[model samples]
Target: MSARMQVRLWLWQRISAALLAPLVLIHLGTIIYAVHAGLSAAAILGRLHGNLWFGGFYALFVLACAVHAPIGVAKMAEEWLGWRGARVTSLAAVFALLLLAGGLRAVYGVVLS
Candidate 1:
């Protein structure tokens, strides 16, 4: 990859990390609240169902994750695993696709269906 592309990916990873930090906190807090409130599965689903805001939030979260994890993994591979060049990037691409596919499916099930 070109140096410019690598820099772009680095910037994206940082941006995504910044976005995800607050989101993760909110997500965990919500989980805690739901568990404390003894919210049943049906109740949780009811809350999420047809909620555009919830869907959008999760979609953003998933997108950020898709962008973030692969870059981090690629960096890890380069640093710790002594892997680099196309192989590392190819694996990151695959990981990103899997994350997107699964995360979007989950978003569909919980918020759209």
Candidate 2:
């Protein structure tokens, strides 16, 4: 990758991490609250359905994860596996797309179904 591109990726990774920190805490807290309240999956979905704010929050969470994970994976591949160049970058991009698709699908199901 070009130096500028690498810098951009680094910036994005940090930005996504910043977004994720509080998101993850909120997500975990929600999970704990759900379990403590003995809420079933259906019950949770019932509350989430048609709730735009909840859906938007989770969508942002998914987006941050999509951006965050592949950058780390690409870096790991470079460091640990000694991989580089377009192929590694392409694979990382593919992984990010998959995360986005799957995560957003789940969010859609919960929020719209």
Candidate 3:
């Protein structure tokens, strides 16, 4: 990647990290509270389903994950797998697709089911 691209990716990763922090905390806190309260799957699903705010939050969370993971993986591959340039870019693209697919699937299960 060029210097400009690297800077952009770094900025994006930082932004995504900032977005993820609160979402992750909220998710973890909800899970812990729900488990402590003995909330059933159906009860949790009830809160998630038909809730636009929750849906939007999960969507944003998924998008951030999609952006964050590939960039991190690209750096990992460069260090560990000796990948760079086009190869790293292609791998990151595949990683992004997989992240999007899995993340959105989770969001759908949470929000739609």
Q: Which candidate gets the maximum TM-score versus the true structure? A: 2
Error of 3 at 109 (Å): 3.2
List clash counts for every candidate, in order: 0, 0, 0
Model 3 alpha-carbon miss at residue 85, Å = 1.5
Position 104, candidate 3: lDDT:
85
Model 1 score (lDDT): 0.95
Error of 1 at 13 (Å): 0.8
Show where candidate 2 strays beyond 4 Å. Answer: none
User: What would the per-residue lDDT of candidate 2 be over residues 4-108, giving only the tens digit for each residue?
Assistant: 999999999999999999999999999999999999988988999999999999999999999999999999999999899987898899999999999999999
- Candidate 2 local Cα displacement, residue 7, angstroms: 1.6
**Cα lDDT of model 3 by residue, 36-109, tens digit:** 99999999888788887888888898999999989999999999989878999999999999989998888888
The residue ranges of model 1 lying beyond 4 angstroms of the native Cα positions read none
Q: Give, for candidate 1, the lowest lDDT window spanning 10 residues.
A: 77-86
At residue 30, candidate 2 shows an lDDT of 95
Q: For each candidate, C-alpha RMSD in Å? A: 1.2, 1.0, 1.3
Off by over 4 Å in 3: none
Two-way lDDT contest, 1 vs 3, winner: 1
